[model samples]
Target: MSKKLNIGLVGFGCVGSGLYDVLNRSNLIDAKIKRIVVQDPKKERSIDQSYFSFDINDILNDPEINVVVELINDSASAFEIVSQALKKGKDVVTANKKMLAEYQAELIPLAKENKVSLLYEGAVAGSIPIIRNLEEYYNNDSLTSVEGILNGTTNYILTQSNSGIGYEEALKSAQELGFAEADPTLDVDGFDSKYKLVLLLKHAFGITVAPKEILNVGIRGISEKEVAYAGEKGYRIKLLSRAEKIGDQVVSFVAPHCISDQHSAYNVHNEFNAVVVEALFSDKQLFYGKGAGSHPTGSAVLSDVSALKFDYQYEYRKAQSNGGLKYTTDAFIKVYIGSKYVNAIEEVAFYSVEETFQSAAYSFQVGWVKLEVLFDLNLNARKDLSLLVLPDSIQTEKGLSELIEKNLFIYENQN
Candidate 1:
């Protein structure tokens, strides 16, 4: 029999409130929100005031509260809350991806030292249950790569853009629908997906990598040219988070990629996320779910709470047995670069050129470029350029060439 959980829920935001509502409504788990700590106690809430508290120690000091669910938006403060909770001998569940990605190296050890479970299934792909799956199911599998649409806000915006909607308008709709935040830079600029990717790398490959070390290019500057190309090429533009193990080293990045309908993530859209995992024996597997929303994320947090009742904690089996796998940005990837200037495409010494398209309005080049070189270009190069990775299973010289040989490029001259 499992022990009843006394949960201290911090931050009554979307995910926090959603967890509260779900936990109260469901009898599936013998857990209750003993106390909720919020920054603004003055803010009106649907629940009674008796359940709320303004101090952190109200729950931390109370020995009865065994679980701390931190769902705050502020990453810095969240780190503090999680750290203190673990030190106080309370298991923690957090939905803040940024905090986890930034502080996993420190936090994970802290949890282990204190002998408490710190789970964050809600941090990565919302309701996907990916963290648990990677920890338990795929623990023994020799995973080669994990890639897919990891951000629903950008995915939703991109899906809306495909329906002839402008980027700003689509973003506005996502914001209004609660799929995106009021300030969408973290989503639009690709930082959110990048943070999630960091967590994925840890679980999928047992590698600890700083988020900044990964080359991240978000969907910030997506234009009609790329959208039109996708429509014409029968492809969908998605911000993909990819990490692949090559030999002893692993390369990872989060960027916008052009994917065809044959791909599993092609149909996943509008606040939905899909992750494709490739193992030596398993071949290919896809996990799809609602990646954003109050209830979806809350449900994930609730799931973590239930697990705590049974004393279920991740063992990180791979991390223990991992043979010093290295994380690297030093790689090569095939990409489609569209720019207003021809020099932008011609400037880089590409590994190999596959196809090039030119038009009166804009132009694009398809070729292989070194990962580090491309990462620097995206960071320091011209802001007007848009880079999209060409969808290919194998990014090797022969494999990329074979894939590109099957494509047809059409050059349009409006003059």
Candidate 2:
């Protein structure tokens, strides 16, 4: 606790380099500890020679290193590395949201059993401080719902397209700006948001739901008609990660939503991510900032290091006593086969709410129903089917304040 904390870096990638630079910089915290870069000696693993290097074994065996900072992006070795470090009695910090979200139940218990802190401030919202903020400030107040634009690549693409640019132009601009990944599949297809949602589910509600439970739908299907209509109606098209406790069940998804100017989510344009969490106190709070990349995300990692080096004594954490939740899927008013499954089931279960009764939009099922009924599901309907909770920008006249107010109010008595 006297000198700087020793950092054992598992990967020398962009985030790893930012961590190295932060700890070593003279003007900042004046950290005295040095970071040792653990490399696969068998691989080229090109990095500055000045960085301390040894086989992965050297890091696990080195008693001098009391903290392990994991920046490795893959699941295979990341699992092994963090597992080994916790067993060795070292505190851990990581930015691998994908691995953390998928294997949290497997490792969180291990870290707790070993009396070591497994910190992941950099895993979500980059520099937004969303994770610990909810974990520390909103305990016991029933986080009834949490939603955000969690992936920057999709956000950037949608934001750019909102200005009249097409998806191709927006994607190219995002790639050029470094907001989109080179391959961009995970971020574009909503896998990245799904991974981040896993972290939110665990941290916000103490619900250890897997990424698969919540439907993951990318923004690729967002149409020009939708965007143009939203823009005209005073809304922004964003790939929103929305989760809520509906009636007796919890339901979540990643999809395009039209948010109004009244919501902060509409302001989170470009690569920024924003979260609106409904707490038990009947409050809906907003946290916003850049969602990813080297500097900002590394800043999140450094914040964890600073906490370990100076404040772990005061940090309080509590895992749910029961620690088990059955996933919720009961909110399905309508169910259908996806468009991709169109060849399988021609007719699907389609319900028109009291609010959307006039439009008469019917859902098609590729695998679940007979080929004929797809034609008449919407023919019978009331004129007032509930508005589909579409984004504000998309539906100029629609409002979610009633639903949002309902969600926020549920927490008041409980908090």
How does each model score on TM-score? 0.93, 0.78
lDDT of 2 by residue, 1-415 (tens): 4445777787877788777766666366644334555556554544456566766776788888888898987877898899999999988899998888789888888987888888988888888898887677776676778899898889889887788888778888999998887888788767888888888876775667777666565666555645655677687777777767644345666656667788778878888888899976868988889888778888898888777765352132323531444446444322212232333223334332212111223322211121123223331131211111354211001123344356568867579
Q: At residue 82, what lDDT does model 1 achieve?
A: 96
Error of 1 at 217 (Å): 0.6
> Clashing residue pairs, candidate 1?
none
lDDT of 2 at 246: 48
lDDT of candidates 1 onward, in order: 0.86, 0.67
Total clashing pairs for each candidate: 0, 18
Q: What shift in Å separates residue 40 of candidate 1 from its native position after superposition?
A: 1.1
Runs off by more than 4 Å, candidate 1: 379-382, 393-415
> Over the stretch 22-129, how does candidate 1's per-residue lDDT look in tens digits?
887888988988999999966998899998999999988999999999999899999999999999999999999999999999999999999999999999899898
